[model samples]
Target: MRIRNSVIVITGAASGVGRATALHFARHRVSLVLASRRVEALEALVAECQALGSRAIAVPTDTSEYDDVRQLASRAVQEYGRIDIWVNNAAVSFFSPFLAVPMADFRRVIDVNVMGYVHGARVALERMQDQGAGVVVNVASIVGAVPQPYTSAYSVSKAAVRALGVSLGSELGLDRQKHIHVCTVLPPTIDTPFFQHAANYTGRRAVAMPPVYSPERVAKAILRLAERPRHELVVGRLGRSMVRQHRLMPGRMEKVMAHQVENTHLSKKQAADPSSGNLYAPSLDPATAQVTGGWKGRRRSARRTLAGAALLGVGVVVLADRLRTART
Candidate 1:
């Protein structure tokens, strides 16, 4: 798909990966239909994109609702005749034990992360079928493939999202709708506002897992996918490696992820009571949408990476020992 002069719709456009992606596409001079719950941030982004010499509109939307997503599609077509690309990037996260997480919080995470993508895909496919071509990019996560501890709701929702993309792609192929592409992006822990907005129950300050990539990197991959769509893409080096390692040694990889989750995903500093941050409502702070989540602990990523390497080393030694014993 030619990005220049194409019309694209992006959900969760107010901040983080979505915002970075929007700016990236804006550089290509594509018309943009931006949607997010934060009206003020959305409006500000609209102006920013417009200043970049692209036609853009901000539609304050809660993507968890089918109606809101449907309306977004209608508005995009109404303004730009057709949509060439649609990106499902709206999502929420919950960091808590599986049993400790409230049912309401869990349900809300599923609604936004899983159902939100479903609504976007359903509406985009309908319009694209009539138009005879379009691309749908779903932003899933490596956590979808490799679930982590204390993030049951978030991991499950992401896993479902990845499945949704695979199923949709298969169906589209079966229906001979090759021109309408469904691509899934499985990114590693990114430095985004997602941690700030995630509902936390660990009684510690929330932080993303280590080896965090800049949101711009994921945004760039998404832009590339919009140009040449693939069935699935893993964004970061660590994330891609994790997927391969998990495939080869599931139990060992699980232990590595659990170690990272326990040591990296939470701050040692004491935090306030558990609250569903931005799960039920939009974040009012414009700063929440910044590219970086402002998590600056001393060499956190380096330390975590070293810890992961140590775990891998131990696993290899244990395996070698087991093999020697079996041979003897």
Candidate 2:
């Protein structure tokens, strides 16, 4: 797991957590193959990584296409001679009620989010099997474990990602491929452009939920996984708390999540006209490729801190009541 000098392949490398992760590994002297649909953004990220002293290249890729992903892996090996780690981070989402969402948009989300990861894993693992050693990190979400109210397709896709990691890990173990590993990372609401880029149909502007952590934090977790692979890692304190609550009280947690999504996941004061954000095409705006989403202001940070603490307290009380009932 020595990351220094390792060759890493990252999808969705143009923006958000993927961008942050690329910069992080660049500091460690790793060779990087960055992929995304935005050629301009990917080229910019490659320049930045090169400035940071890493050997890097940008591959314009639409991960939903199996051929594009296959070529990406081939390109990585062609350049670096070997793939040490493959990170499946490319994903798209939509904010809509289950029935209200257009079938095409929902399917697009699945294609880019779920099948995108599938293609990445399949190609990455195929190459890794030939090498006989490599790690694959799948970026999932906390919503995967605890479903939200409106973003049904997103939740389903993320849950499928988690399941895919588990199944892949089990198969590797069964086949006795000890050196090959698949890791899943579950992060909470992150300060990223994902909210702005997601296709919206709820008639409201989407927003990152409270207690939003920085993309850099998730990048650090991913870096740790590359150094020491684990089956699953949950980023952020609030995310871990929510996952624990869901495990303890499934019915109650679902109710709480529904309320949370309805009240806070979207802007109550602002209305949005329906538009496909970046599901079908990458955003042309240069601003869409940055690392942070301007969501980490001081006031919002303070508010999120208080909100997270309150939610954690409520979870504790709910679990205590459940335990008491069991005893009775």
Best by lDDT: 2
TM-score each candidate. Answer: 0.94, 0.97
lDDT score, candidate 2, position 259? 82
Over 149-266, each residue of candidate 2 has an lDDT whose tens digit, in order, gives 8888999999999999999999999999999999999998889899989999999999988878899989999999999999999997778888997887788878878888888888
Q: In model 1, what are the clashing residue pairs, if there are any?
A: none
* Residue pairs with backbone overlap in model 2: none
lDDT of each: 0.87, 0.92
Q: After superposition, how far is residue 24 of candidate 1 from its true place, in Å?
A: 0.4
For each of the candidates, give the backbone clash count.
Answer: 0, 0
**Candidate 1 lDDT, tens digit per residue, 1-328?**
8889999999999888999999999988989999999888888898999999899999989989999999999999999999899999999987888888889999999999999999999999999999999999999999999999988888898899889998999999999997899999998877788888888787888887677777888999999999999999998656777887788778888888898788777887757478888999987777896757875422356854775576567567767977999999
